[model samples]
Target: MTGAVVAGAVVGGTAVLGGCAASPTAPPSATARADVTRVTVRLDDADALDDVVAATWALGVEALREGEDDDGTVVSPSSLLTALAMLGEGAGDGHAPFDAALGAVGDERTDAVNALLAALARYEGDPALVAADKLPVVPMLHTAQQIVVDDDATPQRAFLDRLAAGYGAGVVVDDLATRSDALDEFARTHTGGLVPTSPITPDPNLVAVLQDAVVLAAAWKTPFDVALSGDQPFTVVGERVLVPTMEGEFDTAAVSADGWQAVRLPYRDDLVADLYLPPEGSAAADDPSAAEPTTLAGLSTALDDAAADRVLVRLPTIDLESTTDLMTLLAGLGIVGADLTGVVEGSAVQAVQQAVLQVDEEGTRAAAVTSVGVTESLRMPPPNQVVLDRPFLMVVRDTTTGWPVFLAEVLDPRAG
Candidate 1:
């Protein structure tokens, strides 16, 4: 079904929050830096932060469970929650579903999300200052949110207002089908080129897209020694693979309980990567879904009861990326058929997330983008339709010489 865009342009005199005004230009990059300004707000109530953390971890675990890849999986709970929270704000009759899915409602959820954003703001810096080849000595986390609507579509004032106030989100009015390159630049600018393109594909029926992006680069408080790094055997879904591994003993928070061992590897600042390992030889060790749900659900409590201590560790240097369609996942969370009349009428929701993470002896760097697109329920036919649903042979050839450049059997899109 196609959704309808509400009539009329945004009224004048609307306050732009977070000291950054929305861009008047049609190109997305005009406001990219402005959108990343550090949000200034009193921290939300502790209860709100707690609720948000719980919800984030819960969703992160589910994302891994739903992923079928054995190579690895990565999900940015903060990016996902930030985008979804904006969607929740625009939900009219569909509000309750987002509430249940997020485990918070009303001002609680709003404050929770805003609070999380504010907290993360402490680490944010100019994305231009970062370089992938050299991890910054000073930690940085760049985050920004924006709502882009088709120039022809008029957005609701109240919905936009809430987003500006609660999320510090900027608004962009551009032609989604033609101005998509601008959106890609915005993503690249915010993510320091870690993710160079926006995940949202423009469709004739698309009206609006809510986007959140995060780029993190930080050094470990205690860097792993390069001298100690060497090739080692590591288990990967049962098979042992010899990979470059980093070995070290460092002071960190750790806990063992309910057939799990976990540790918090601290960054130079507040950020940390919490690694949880399932019992060796158990199915859960090989598969994320095999673990008991409570193992992840009570992770916070378990870690809270533990104290920081020196722990010996061996970890592989790694680089991983994943792009996932979260429409089915959101539906599973009770957000099916969302009513986003607060933004526009007849809206249908589509969510996509892309994440990249790298870890080495120096530290860790990661980036993620989450996009929730709202389109009309009634749609125009796509310009092209190509579906590789069945097994088939694929070939890449030079048109002039009929010389095959590459060829392969087509099956399992997930296969590498």
Candidate 2:
């Protein structure tokens, strides 16, 4: 939405962080299903829960920008902590001390923000790159690890139990058979409605110690309806076709340049989504070869210039689903400094080797599930009318740090 555009240039220095990497070839297909019972659990502290929620949101944002829209929001910070507290046996009032310890990690937070920004820079056509005076938004980042033991039970149960405990309230773990099933159950239980779950294949031996990271999210308080969305004509690359449309009044700051417009869409639910439109006869539309070399940094400068005003927004009601390999994305973000070859290096669980080693042996299997719907109402009129119906980039970002963990392109709204 429309707000003061803070003018602060992000420093150009860079640093490398260690993370996971996927193999060049795809893994073998495995089909396994499990139906376990639902369990209730909790976390030990608020701050630890907050970090989980925030990280999930960041990851979701990157997924959205990467073109995966399935219809679920990341888990909130408060709910995650509550879940952790419930599962931790003998956890009393010590949550406060845990929170204090988390708050003291200022240096880690700074490093996280830097790493994320570097990641965001890899997006080829970011709208923020068009802005004149770029503002640096720094977000705090944290991580936690835990182990659950049930001598008489399967390792899968331990993973599911910890997952149930991490969600706090507003969630229930159910029908868990394998480690992948546990992850799917966690996604279904926390999401407000029925949403599809991403597939995961965990090695049997590493299942107990290597928990599938859980993420929860909540949509904007006011959501758009699919029924209200309609079909409108959109032109992309000299091709025009009818596309689903959603038009409504939204307070947004827009940046305009010679032949392009960039708008920052802020949802009432505390998330920011950005959109970029190319002007008629612009290089993006005229020369297909030239578009490949365009950088987000250049677009950010244009956005700074055109983002000084608000307008009536008319955008297509888009529904999408896609998958991303985390290792490739992180490497693009400059996280190559650490030896990320083992599972132990990138994961919270200490049992597995580094992610790289895991990929070499058992293989690394990680993916995200995303869904987005936006509808616009025409009751109010503004000085300008903006219609979005072409191939454009969108990103969901954390309010604290401008870093985008999820990134994607709306190539064709009509496609499944």
Per-residue alpha-carbon lDDT of candidate 2 for residues 129-243, written as tens digits (9 for 90 to 100): 2122221232111111122221112333333333333321122221212333433333332221122342333322221221222121213223344455677877655578887
* TM-score of each model, in listed order: 0.79, 0.45
Instruction: Output candidate 2 Cα RMSD.
Output: 16.4
Error of 2 at 68 (Å): 10
How many residue pairs of model 2 clash at the backbone? 76
Which candidate ranks first by TM-score, i.e. highest?
1
What digit string (tens of lDDT, one per residue) describes model 1 on residues 206-295? 556666666666677789889987776655544555667677777776677765666656666444555556666666655644554345
Q: Give the best candidate by lDDT.
A: 1
TM-score of 2: 0.45
Clashing pairs in 1: 1-377, 1-378, 2-376, 2-377, 2-378, 3-346, 3-376, 3-377
lDDT of each: 0.56, 0.31
Each candidate's number of clashing pairs is: 8, 76
Error of 2 at 355 (Å): 22
